[model samples]
Target: MAIETTSFESRGERCAATWYLPDAVGERWPCVVLANGFSGTRDWILPDFCRRFAAAGIAALAFDYRHLGESGGAPRQIVDVGEQRADLLAALAHARRDPRIDPRRVALWGTSLGGSHALTVAADDPDLAALILNMPAIDALSGANVEEKRKRAGVSRARTVAITLRLVGAALRDLSRAARRADPLYLGVYGEPGEAFFTDPELAPRFRRVAEGSPTWQNRVAARFLLGAPRYRSGTFERVKAPILICLAEHDLEVSADFIRAKAKGAARVDIRTYPVGHFDLYHGDAFEQVAADQVAFLRAHLGPR
Candidate 1:
């Protein structure tokens, strides 16, 4: 399979992506629309999965959100969940328009925070063929307890003050930009554990490992995103009419399986699989192979020819 560079406009900004197609052309094949996790670009780990999907005779469209990776936007490294959702929709629209893709059999594959976007999109677009979530970052604020955070990585008073001031400034800047409909304010996407930010330092090393290899990956996001992150919720699980496949990591402390299981209780059809590994482990080694095989099987069962 030869992966081709692709681009699309989302909210007036260009979002970059890659399209992987099987050698067997002419026949319109089912496609998977894949996006990465929090503060992540499509260059991380996504290519591995996209290649596997293409090998399975499925077309894969992996994309980077605007302002990250090869995508286009100002104030680089800002993580806006709503804007990401828009990017996913734009990718979906692009996939549907492609001549080699089967528009009616399009499926969504989202990892970590991207999973939240996948569920939210699937809920509203009932025509989607399937949904796959891998250790999604849902309800991020509710995960860490105050006491546990303190134990994980204690913070100095000076660092605390600095973080507070930075966040306050970011929030104000974000508000001002919104008023004028301008680009977002930027900030480091990761912080040490116990610090008030997106991912803990304990879990932040994964970003370093991924970045060591990917030139497109960066550790930044819009600081104003913190203000709206907690309040944003994907309450569309019940409305997601497509078949759902959730691959959960047993040791993942960020996203709780219990929470997802509870919210998706009303879903029409859901298949939940548990892997005995940490969150990032699922991206490589035996765990990655297992997850890929299972996902291929699931998509084959649901999105394959009728």
Candidate 2:
């Protein structure tokens, strides 16, 4: 296997990427473009998956979204949904343009929020060979009801209300800063309930454990992004024509499995797999091994030599 450092332009910004290529003799090998989750860098937990794909005779391209990691963007750590989708598309284009990659056999692999971006991008580009989504944050695609979210998260109505108010305040502050051309307010990516954007108590430790060796991963994001999150819904699943593999974490506190199932019901070529673990579990330990193996098998079956 060989690894190459690369960069791609997205909306005038340079997005950093790494290509993991297999050592096989194929003139043009199948490729998989990978995007990281919210606040996740290209170096975080993604290298493991990329290595596995390369070992299976598939090429993997992992990139950092603009405004995060090594990518070029002003007012760093902001998570703009539209910008992220565009970045993924840019990565896809980069992979397709590479001489060593088979454009017709290029696929997309994403986890968490990245998965949702991949889904939306694949919906527009039907010619993609396949797609792999692991514990995708599809709830963002539909603007999941606040009450239902509170109930599922086991948080009281009052606590949920407080959290919303806090988010609004932070968003307003950041917007005001943007208007004044000042620094933006930041919010932690993981924290205890009602403390941060991702209010899962266990996420902090799990994220730390998974991102231990990664120096580029940041724990904060611009607060204003939360203001537009509710309106960030996408209705492109039904339009995606490529074969898709959806891996769900049954006990995920961030995104409910039922929400993903209901949204994916209309997609024609989807294979769903549910694992008895939390959202972060799939990034480490035995769960990671099992899920990664399943994904490799899926990729081989769909993107194998043709």
Candidate 3:
């Protein structure tokens, strides 16, 4: 397998990307365009999946969304869902135009929050060969059963309310700052209990481990994004015509497994796979192996050399 550094333009900003090519050269290969989850960079856990694809005779393009990682953008680490979707589309266009990739066989792969973008994008893109969502955060906040989620995470009602107030305050403050052309307010991506967006004590270390050596992976994002996040729902699954693979973690604390299962029921060509693990577990160990293997098989079956 071979890797190359590249960039693509998205809404006038340059997004950094890594191209993983198969050993067999001089032939166009089916490609998968990969995007990371919430506040995740291309370097975090995505390289492992990209390497697997390249080794399996498929090309993979892993990209960092603008304003994050090595991507070019000012006032960085903003997580705008709409802009991220645009970045994914731009990455798809870049992949389709590459001579080393089979334009007609380009697939979309997204994990966590990235999966939500993939699902929404694939809904309108009928030409995509396939779509793979790994432990996707589809509904996110809007359609989520917050009470159930909080209960599962052992978070009390008082804590949930407090978190909500903090999030709202931060978002409002960031919005005011934006209007005044000042720097955006930031929020930690993960922290000790009650200190960050994701306060899970056990998962915090795992996230840090994933981002261990990543130079561009920041542990924070613009707080203003929280204001528009709830409205950024991924409800286009039923509109997607391509073959879809949706991986779910039964014990996911970040994304509700039951919500995804219910939302997927409306889709026509979805294949659901459930694992006895949490959201972060899907990125490593036996769980990662099983999920990645299943994804490879799905991609190979659907995007065969053509």
Off by over 4 Å in 2: 141-155, 192-194, 230-235
TM-score of 1: 0.87
lDDT of 3 at 111: 89
Kindly report which residue pairs in candidate 2 clash with one another: none
The sequence of per-residue lDDT tens digits that candidate 3 reaches over residues 1-306 is 999999989999899999999999766899999979999898888999999999999999999998998998888888988999999999999999998788999999988889888988998999999999988776657445577657767888998898789888988999999899899888889874444678766776787675677778988888887776733344577788899999988877777777788788888898999999887899889999999999999999999967
Q: Model 2's lDDT to the true fold?
A: 0.85
TM-scores for candidates 1 onward, in order: 0.87, 0.93, 0.95
Kindly provide the TM-score of model 3 when superposed on the true structure, using C-alpha atoms: 0.95
Order the candidates by lDDT, highest first: 3, 2, 1
The per-candidate count of clashes, in order, stands at: 6, 0, 0
Q: After superposition, how far is residue 118 of candidate 1 from its true place, in Å?
A: 0.7
In model 3, which runs have C-alpha deviations exceeding 4 angstroms? Answer: 142-145, 230-235
Please estimate how well model 1 matches the true structure, expressed as its whole-model Cα lDDT.
Answer: 0.81
Give, for candidate 3, the lowest lDDT window spanning 10 residues: 226-235
